[model samples]
Target: MPGVTDNRKSVLITGCSPGGIGNSLAREFHQSNLRVLATARDAANIADLAELGIETLSLVVDDLESVKACFADVETRLGDKGLDYLWPKYVNNVEDTKYYTVPAMEVEISEVRKTFETNLFAVITMCQTFLPLLIKAKGTIVQVGSVAGIIPYVFGSVYNASKAALHSFSDTLRVELAPFGVHVTTIVTGGVQSRIARTQRTLLPNSMYTPIESEYSRRVTHSQHNAMPHDAYARSVVAQVLYGPAPWRWLWPWAKGRKAWIWEGHRSWLIWFLLARGRPIAAAFKAATGPSVQSRLAMQQKRNLSIHEYLSARLLKTYGIGVPNGEVARSGEEAEAVAKSIGNDDMVIKAQVLAGGRGKGHFDNGLKGGVRVIYSPTEAKMFANQMIGHKLITKQTGAAGRDCNSVLICERKFARREFYLAILMDRALQTPIIVSSSQGGMDIEAVAKENPEAITTTPIDINTGVTDEIARTIAIDLGFSEQCIEEAKTTIQNLYKVFMERDATQIEINPLSETSDHQVLAMDAKLGFDENAEFRQKEVFSWRDHSQEDADELDGDIGCLVNGAGLAMATMDIIKLNGGSPANFLDVGGGATPAAIKSAFELITSDPKVSAIFVNIFGGIVRCDAIAQGLINVVQEMGLRTPIVARLQGTNMEQAHKLINESGLKIFSMEDLQNAAEKSVQFSKVVKMAREIDVGVEFTLDI
Candidate 1:
């Protein structure tokens, strides 16, 4: 133990391992002229810090006795001068999906307890043990928490819960420690650059989790690469923590950082909804031995209900909602027959896929759009033949698109007036809110953004439901004609009944059309049911079109195949901000192998709408050259013609750039993010212009 030397400002940081957050912060604080005491589980682990004149100590923070002894030694050394800062920033994460995917009752109690011991109890103990020293100096306590705590994800329940508990503790500590002139601040960080890619352990094999391990692991791999660089992260964190006039909570320092994604509630909710609905959470935990675990699991598992237009239309019909007469046809002959059976009236044939923007999508076999309005049975048969058994790509379908296994032949009805209407649960109000706009089609979100006044939002009380008063108010807000008010009210009531009875999360009728005859029709219906209610609503769950989804897909024009969800989204937003449309959201992940990269390359290039592709890689555990090689292999094998703009950073960056350059392919490299994005946009525009000039869409095809 070192004895008290000078009165310089001091900071004691636990878990100062190399390539870790604590170590980075220690360096940052030391550079700021603070007397730094960096502690780790093993003194030898942080021996390098001593070279920089930092005092190092071996302290197993999770063990109470170790914590006490460490504090005692510190007390003996520092004396009454005490400690100016105490950062309890240690953490333990269980990456094994099995630990969380298993029924809570089935998971070994010891495992969960151990995680809490390190992530939660130990932090609390360290604070308790060091309180006297901190109080004497009126020091600030910085607790580094994670966003995972605030928004828990699957396979991270235990770790997320522990951090959540710690967050609560930090809040309480801030209040309790205030009277002593002591400050407590919580830094809720998102993915920050660290050695996470190297340190993340593989899932330990258990019969319960082995089968689904690969799937979940692939799902989380990109998060590691999406982390903020440690130097930048540490500097940002320390600046906030050390600056005078401390607040109870620290906002994310860099506006461009990953933390912004957490507060974008709608975006985050969409991600969660997609993940929850796509997987069978109920089946994953069916082996749980306890009834409570099973029951709770059942309740939460019924999220992410998948329903296409046909299924949704059928659901509406059940509630007496007016829908165009339609019948499912699996083949062109079937579609023609269906058309003939309906007496050859103008008809709309729509591809039966689970994605949006079908009107603007096309099939690979020269079929234009998922929806086609035709006056003849021959045209219906031709469109059906082109769509059925062909891949249909839309802005939402990514490059690969989805198989058109069926088509819906519905009578085409023209609307004299169109309006957008939807009922959805409002998180802020904790109630069902009805959103309606006089103008509608596929761009309701855009209308809501640009002309919010046109969009009326009415919050409904659960007890009153959609009463006559509420219906009249909604109809008036929608500018419904006096003659149409009663009919509109009836439609609203039926929709509300469907929403309540089916436990639906969202009911949208875009362009709830008014025909020339003045009849209201559910022209296009989209319904999302509460996934948790699937057990009770078996009929709704049965309609899930799993084929419409890939392992991952996000809507955009410029395809993004980055490594982490946060980074992937950031890239997409940046593209949009830079006047570019993202073609799809594709995360190859942190540990993507050469083969995976090749697959990703092929997938992105296959999309006709994806004029250009952007590949942003922050190689942490993944070597940059491996990614370059994958790109090269795909270009050589498939002769990819799409323009590619890549930004490669991190491990073996030089080699990665070299490999791509030497390949002599039509790939452009830019290490800077903005530069790469601009190039991708320019190239995408070029692709668009060139295709317009020539009927046969083609690029230079050479690097």
Candidate 2:
């Protein structure tokens, strides 16, 4: 085996595209004093590596001939030294929803074949070609597996299966090559921040997946939140491979806890196959049962769902469901007054917080509990005082507890029986499901864990609202008496109404109690509305709390203002690709107003780190001309001197360009997003250099 030496160490990584793992790893390895050869399908893609003393090569892993030629080239370059590390990181990810979400039978065979050709076949070929080199050096072979292979989430079957195959290959390779002293390590990657998530959308067969394309897109965008930054992920992997001498089989740098939970939850194929096969058949059955009835429930004219408890109560009342007659108190004094209004009856003073497990929580100032049973107004005031000003920590709240700014003082009532009633969107069924159980209260999750069969679920089609017959059946199944049947049925019907009207993703009444008076009352409820439907739910949208957001976002240097989440992410990535780090991600949303755009600008510029701004808008609902006007308004009013690059496309883009060009502002309005990104980076560099020069001149003057 070749001994470790700074000059002797060499690493070759394939698929070194800009903003990719290979590119990042190559750069980092070079910085660590290792000879780095960054290869891609096109050498031109990695041309920039020459500046950093990293060699670039055109190596197509998919082509067997290309793989052989690449090996020959590596051997010739390294001469008798032998290769230290050979990373064949060529990955092809197809974004077709069917490949991930649909049944394997539904996915096109061509797509599967194409994916395996790159991800599996190419990988195997590369490993065989490089085994000799790695054996010579006693180096590590890092196989980049994914969490998808471990969990195999719904709609990601093909990709998951491909990764699973790769993982198996790596394991087998490890055992076979152990005697050769070539170590094989599988990096089970969590979500890594990359342009692939954004750019891969275009590669999806949107026309073919007409039924679920929008949902697929939403899921793709939603998943990016947990993605580890590419550079950070690369650094960790490179460190483990280069510095760590121990034979570590798996390196998990992201979603450690999540991965563990997923592994535990992963079940057998019997349930999976049944569910996958039944989806379309079930949809067809549901459609046949109804005469294409439209929903009678009124849609929210304005606003979106924000705070769970308060909004839930309001929506429950609106739908005529019985709830405790109480209001949210922002202070201890207000809580006291509300307690008084309950006329000294037994009142439950509950700290209003976004997190759950509040009943088992404690306040920061040595307060024992978040919930307290109070007899007098004074008692309510005392508990409120302890909670409202202090942070309430629970199992869900972590160590840094959320601030309890408000409390709910509600009239407490005794119940003969508690029932759990919940309507939640089932992603697999693509419909809302009513989950009801005779046993309810705080231990509902326990019931689910220990006795899942006790809960009855009824999936409802969105087109057809919950029928009276369906409601009666569910109510009866929940052990409701004949007398309470009408009441329970009414509450269930009303709950569906509220869910439809508010565009709620989930409406959970944990303890829907049957009071002594035979009334079905919502004792505790949690309502969560779909954020995508926020535009229609104006009231709910207005309830958005910005305080819960990250402080760094409010203060970043290269502020990004984009329409869609994917576009915003892509813009930020491109900015970074061009050597400029984004300070904030400020998405003005699709139907953004000129006023909203102006507010976005002000918010982004508020961050002292922001010396440059990049705006990439694909105007679908929003016109580009309107966006231009908004930018012009901000620049003129604020006299903004920050270098701005705006890339406008779709929907009156020509008009937008014309308007921006004639605005007399120094903003660069470009037709191409790449050009805009490059311009922003150049301008940011100039700004930084100018600042440094000014400081230099000031120092000389002082001397």
Candidate 3:
């Protein structure tokens, strides 16, 4: 009799915007004769929600104060019987009720903190707070999720992150609530037509673009806009919430739209044609996967954190640090004026585009243009006006216009301090640690020479906050007074907090200046944050100086793409390794296709160094038989003798082996990386032997 009153099905709805799931669910639940307690950040955001004659309340997930108040209001409204969502945890759910969030992409440190409070902690809080009510009700708990919870896409990172976290949370809830008669079900939808679709960045800004520009921007853009309507998505959400067949996940479209069904119907046809032929598709797979592996490995090898001087200049200016004073002169007059202000006849007026290259100036004597070491103020001023808003051509940017906006307007500070104090993450310490020295400026290595003992490393924990103990250790080394040491500790602590909370990868500060007046300034700063952590950090993304960042060859392109960072980098390196520089890096990931392979091949061969090509593919989920057919097609379309070497392993290898071995040219069967590497490297040897033996050689790879 006690449980009968609370036998109605219920859900913890999230994201109760005007046109959102929560509101829609509220209306649906009420219409279906189930209980509805609608909620939103602002009561007015859901005033119309009130018009629906259901529960509406203000619940700000981040602020504990707001959370406590919202629950109290809920209890007051219902009296004796009310309440399921007390929200003890600060996190709010973004799927049905909250926004999507990922740890790496969510970067506004505070926003990330807030998002977690809403999406994650709030779930815990609400569960604990409503434990008594939920137990009494004996109802099923429904959590809304999105496709992003599984797939990795660009942008929507934070939203996806939150949903994924919720998915995990729901799983835990299901296990824990099993004995208490509480059932948990998750809804994972794809292409839901919602306000999110309308508001989503259809054509993201250049900032969102990976280093490479997309060739299929139109196709990609169109696909993005073609998502399913919100109502259809809502219906499924309601069904899952009201029903209780929860095993792991419930994909909508029932038997009709299950991905495996669609994949078989669609891709199977293409696969069958290849399987029937047993010739073309097998060839192409071998061909495409060949270069992809090498490209991935090359990418990994070159990824480094070495600081460029251009970035070093600005970072040194922050933290009260100082670098050599420089002038932002465009024309000769401005250069002269800047020189006059300095009152020094000798001046170094360098090209201000965020690039490297000045010593290799256009003309000798360092005077014609670009960057010149002028002896007089008039000469400096003359160079300034000429460069203002004008393209500064260098070997790197070529003749095209550069994105140069500001010039460093500074007075020269000649070599007074030259010590390098870099606060680096010594993986050994596995934390943000400090590195300092007495010397400042110029050659950091030279300073390391004069006195290596001058440098000191200090580790700190930001949670306990800055303490007096660490302050004393640093003070003793830097020779600071107790007060100054305490101040220094506070600064260090703040900086460390910035590093961890913000998801920064590295914050390199070189030459922490101990000015002549005993004042400390950061002479230069070189900061790099995990790009994936951008969602949580607004400032980190804003500070991106593409001026110093090189474009990734495989970033955004149409190519015979394969996935795996290590493999992609290696493929690129191999091409270069074999004296054939890859045109670009393109990986197909889980969606590797012959067409994609063609695109990758085109992009890779775009470089003249790619005389011919060698492709090595390790098909794990992708069957080697499919890869072989792809290669066979490639050779038939593009013609064999395009100078290709392929080594394929994993499932269907036998079938693939049969296809390649039977193809006109002998598909070299080499075991292990040693022979495979040597085969590609010794393409000349292969080519010469085949030629000497009077075999047909396609193209001459001049390696």
Candidate 4:
């Protein structure tokens, strides 16, 4: 009112509470010598601005009568001078209700209405009520918008929709107000530090997102960290409004200009570029919610459980199936004693490693072969000494060979005919099937690939099992000798019994031999049992050789801990796509607890080649916050030096992120898959470079 008759300009700013963009903007405008009218729902909220000599008014933007009264008051104070600038900046208050972050289906309809009314309807009403005064002064209308309107972030659907509608409204208003000599500017704000998210937030009691409820508070305050300061944002916005390009230039007959859509705050430019280029934001979203790698690994583990040759032979003997007289020995002296007890002139000593191609494989202890024929007990001891307590590297073993803790000594049997016989689960038919082949003592996979017709398959009904007729048919098809036909048929029936009783997924006897003595024997056996049946098959499960299992170390630079097989593959694929090498694929499983998380970290860190670790988990059956806390504990307990990039989604993901951030560890929490992958690769390279430099220094010192 005091500056009404003066030459100074005037601005009416709403939602100008302390520590907000509007409050800072009001002060900035006043510092520039303009008459400022800062308004809040409660005048006491803007008392700090009032103390700075700025006029404060109590106005509720959503209340129609309050908007009209405020307009009348401004009209009376300004008289013919009118208002030079109209700024409406208001958002739905989360403190008003606890169900603000609940899923769309669970949130109350009234809360949705309130949000729309506050963010969209209120601004439109404010603009309509003050348009006359604004037009009279040819002032600018600054509509505060947000990146949330453009980006589809989780847990703020209502707020995002309200802001999106406001954005659309501002675009239409800009075109409509061009001829009126009034300007409409939309501020597409990114992450700016503000009081909007200061209050604590919660989801509904029966929310479907309850598993991720810890994420709600984190999402509410997501912009508070590393966000542009409110004052800095205000300075940039005011500078753009007062000195940037004119909004109506595009509407003129000769000039070509567009409406002002200022993108300010952190990551604004990157988001704009991504949106403009039509990048797949949804892919990033999928990376968070995809099946966990741990779940897939659990499935893989359950489906794959095979025993060693010696154990398979022992099981065969129990079922009345003929096998070579053999004994497993952990030491060379024991192997000699077993060979001597058998009293055979010819014997075969084989390294008891899990991998195939054992006969052709070389041992780490300078043994030329894993399997060897011996003529005496002394020869058996010599070969056993070379085979035991050494690593056997085969085609299947890769460079990291399997450890051999024992050797099998058996009397060599001369076979008149060698044939392959196997009992396998036919998943498609949901039954057991017996496969027989005339070709044996060679790779079954190779035989199948090279000559599929050489194999004969016979399905067995679970109720009837392997009858005498079926066993005889398989023996005849396998080309068993006439004298050994009855023996072969009995062996086949006994093998089937072993398969069913042991819950065997597969039982293969490569070279089910017909000896010169007219005896049918399972010369070599391989058996795989169902891990799900471990409770009942306790003895079989106990025979599981952990040293035979695949190692966690992959000889790469980036260690990965993911939850699902598909997701783990995708995580690795994306890492490779981004020019980074993954060290290993370790799935912690769907029901991962803190203990499992610690174990996973320990396994990943066990690889000295790993310079960085990437943890990508989608918390479908697991709480992400629990996983996060576990990771924090592991890092602190182990004092891990490797950099970690963690991207957690679903249940309690936000809370997980909060814990990791507050833990002050080397773990980097990222929401976007691409960003997380790139950061991991970047950190890995830095660590590698540092290692190389250290190595160089060490070499120089030694010289």
Candidate 5:
């Protein structure tokens, strides 16, 4: 009312709450000597602006009557000279509509409609209502947009869609309004520090994204810390809006050099560059929302079940494959008795440890070798005494070697010719394949790398299996003697039977040998079974020595509990990638029952170095809700102090989220693999730091 008689440019701005972009814009425009009208839902919110000689109004942008009343008031104040600028700053209550940080599936349809009403439709109504005044003065319309419209960030589906629609509308409006002498400028904003960013948003109670609630919170206030100040943003925007361009100039059309789309705020340059180059931002989006390849590989690795050499030999014997007579011994007297029972002058004693390079390994009890050849029972006894209770360190075993709980004493056989043969599943072909090489009794991996040409692979049909013709051809190719060819063929067929019948993933015979007596024998064997087949292969699984495996369980900081081997391996790889050491890799199996989950937690927490536990489960065979209940039960029962990060996906995940949230425990549920891994690593570091401080304080007090 005071500036109604004066000849000054007037600008009306919406959503001018304190500490907001609209409020700062109002102040900036007022400083530039313009008659600024700052409006909010409540006029009292912008009283500070009114105190600074800026006109304040209460205008609900969404209400048509409110828009009409505000427009009529402005029309009376301006009289002949119309409004110069209209800034419609779209701002919604974050608490009511968390569509900005919620997944598309989890966002309510009603909230989506409300977002469009406020962000797009209401703004359009404002422009339509004020177009007459804007045309009278040849003024500009500034539509506040965001980079999220063009670049797809995580968990911003509805909000991004609304902004994108607004941008398109502005682009068309800019061209259509050119002839009317009313310019429309869409401000493509990046991160700007404002009150809206400070407002915390939460996911819906039944949200599928409940696991990633922390990520949503992080993204909601992401711009709060490192964003450009609202005042700074306001200064730049006002400067460009006021004197940047002429709305109507028929004499000089080229003089209209104002940007139709103005990019401002922090990271605006990066957004512009990305847009210009047409690069896909989906990868960046996926990195924050989806599971990684490393996690999948880790899960696959967990399903493999490897057995000891003696067990493998026993399996080979069961299949009627030729092997040297051998017996397991736990003590020196037992080894001597086994040697005598064999009734052979020459015998070999091998430490029963689950690792490669046993021949080249040394015992921790000052024994020179794990595998030794003896001519008599007395010599066998002496070597067995040294190896039975000692840890055998090999290339495969690190400094902390595997204990030799028993030894295998077998009658020695001289090999006339040695060859390598193996039956394994070919993942790509989805069938079994036989791999063979003339080179044997050495490192198979090195041989494959150095002399790849020497190796031969033959895919086996699942229906027909290994035919006599296939086995004979393989025997001849391996250079078996004419006398041993039939025996070799039989052995090959039997090995295939063992592979199929036992659900074996891999059966590797390092030396399928032709003995001095022209006997074809499997001299040394290693078998790996599919862990998923544990129900059927109970006997094979029974031979599993848990003590000899998962050596890192004692030393690592983060304990991993994953359902599948591939996922488990990926979890571990991601943990290491994020600078956290995995203390143990435990697959609770596909069942994921309460007992299994409880056992897994107990095992993981047993290691004092495990500061945090990461449970990454994909519930395909098992329900995620079941696993979640089990996890809650374990934590409450055990009273676990170590922090747990559980990422459950697949079957009944929504129910799982509900169970976890209602559990009232300190466990963190995460949806993104990368975020979960990073959180686990962070928790581990915090725990370690706390422990170190406690130790330091205790040491000082002791002194």
Candidate 6:
């Protein structure tokens, strides 16, 4: 029962079906002289376990009913021995034969259900059922999460999101169950020698008919076939699992080895976030020389513009640099009062909290001081009165900071170039990557496009400081003349120094333009550090924006809960595509808490201009039963008359869908993203027809 004191004990793993990662792990553990019990959804699946001289049992991670029954069986078999360790190698990205593939439009609700049953729901049920045993064992519970969780592919968003959710859930579980002696470890593998590579290859049917797809199919298939061997990935997993102590998360196959397809996902996200934001990421997909998947996805990966504001204006202001006139005040009284005190005839008033809303002219949360242009104190008062405790919600603020207390008041400064600059951790280079550009302020991508050579990157050795030489070069290239180069170099160097010293994950400065006064000022800035590295950088980490966070991420909607970044990203994508831009990305796909859903709706509605909504729920671990109950209760209380198009799929969907249909709420069942997107736009138009595609759901106004 003692934890980590003895490694020579029994370990139980679920979903040890033949020729799978679980089966391989079971063999390795057995070979290591550990008592290994390998389980599967059915006993028939693990007949190979008997041949390997390991104990086998019937188990299902998805169904609580089946999981409970299996746990009872496991308890009877390994009582007191108590399963010294537990591993879930269940469902290695569904094995794709012909059945897994069909026309994209032909995807069935059942297929969606099949995916979650293995990837998300079952895992939850299994964990709960085994909690007592794992507690008794005082051992580790390892979840096999994926690199796809961090990245997204055109067709694979669902799988990627499920994995992402697992990663997030693992983090929460590790924190919550830490006091109970349960050690939770999540292994985020990049690529490995597994049948999954084969399965992924099969997900796309590469014939000449889809010429663009055929070529991409070949490239992806070859890359996957050559992925690192499964055994190698397994050894990494086993070593970490058995190494006595472990961290909450480990990216085993780092970025250097990842397929370009995956790497592009992560980079594009950061890129779009840096570049064009008020617009949908789909603008990036406008490239011609790409596959349908890439074309579809490129169209959706637009920047999260609010983030740019934080980069240039907010973070820079912290470094003792002058930003175009802006002031931070806590209350509307303070805001209006500050405007009067500043004596500026024209100033921008914004919610000062770490949220975005000022630009939208909504009840802004002051996240990054949601800034708004105002003529006088009266204007400030009008904005403040409306914003006070009114929930300045947005795509990222979630439901918590809707009513903003803090506001940023400042004189508007005229400037040019919506360019970007940032210091971020680069796992590949094992150092910080400095990204700065003469282009991309409001539109980083456009900036990049107009001036491809303008964006300059320098990798700094964390061991030493960023040299004046590198900083000077970057500044000079970014259009800083000789006079400003010294100051610019020093500034760039200091930013890197701060990045390393502060253990920052990201520190962005957007529109690093020359002040109208001819001095350099960061128009916006945002700083983020590694949570794990927080211990070393207390002061920096202490500046946590608990509310401004991508709630879609914390809530597991960051594609993991929703099953695809496309879905996750497209929620934002469709809104913008339909002429009704999204306030933020709220994914209610994974196991969404009722509170999370409520927050999502609240955040979406915070922008009055978001006249309509698209609630696309492709149920995974989140049951239709739970979603229906949650929606009915939450929406009624919110008092929203805005037309809401609800698309629910997965478990108990029929019943839940029926409930919504009869609820007398403004809800419509549209099957595709296209229909939903058009419906969302239409609502904004004449306000007619509620309907929706799944890669980027179909966009049709013909409804």
lDDT of 1 by residue, 348-395 (tens): 999988776788988888777788888877887888888999998886
Best by TM-score: 4
Error of 1 at 454 (Å): 2.7
lDDT of 5 by residue, 244-297 (tens): 311111112332222321222222222222211121111111111111111111
Candidate 5 stretches with Cα past 4 Å from truth are 1-305, 538-555, 559-572, 584-607, 613-683, 689-703
Worst-scoring 10-residue span by lDDT in model 6: 244-253
Candidate 4, residues 444-525, lDDT tens digits: the string is: 6556545757876666778888889988888888888788878888999899999999988778888999989988989998
Stretches off by above 4 angstroms in model 6 are 1-318, 353-370, 393-403, 416-419, 445-453, 549-703
Scored against the true structure, residue 559 in model 2 reaches a CA lDDT of 78
Among all windows of 10 consecutive residues in model 1, the one with the lowest summed lDDT is 289-298
Give residue 422's lDDT in candidate 1 (0 to 100): 84
- Give one digit per residue, the lDDT tens place, for model 6 in 1-703: 2233334577888868777777778887776678777888787778887777787877767667777887887777765656667776547545433222333344566665666567777677777878898888766777754445433333454555556676667667765565465657665433455444344443335444365665345333322422444455555456435531111011112322223222222222322442222222223212210111111222333223123232335565566666766666666677778788878887776665554334543443342335667889888877776665666655444455454555667776666334467776533233466777776456544543345456555666666668878888888888876677787787787777667665566677766766545566666666555556656756554555444444332121111123345455535544443455444555554667688888777766655445466677756567776787788888799986666777666556778877877787776656565576667666654432221111222232222
Error of 5 at 423 (Å): 1.2
lDDT of 2: 0.67
True-structure lDDT of candidate 6: 0.57
- Candidate 5, RMSD to the unseen true structure: 23.0
Estimate, for each residue in 80-171, the C-alpha lDDT of model 3 and write its tens digit: 55333221212223343224322243245666556566567767666665566656554445555443432333444565566567667766
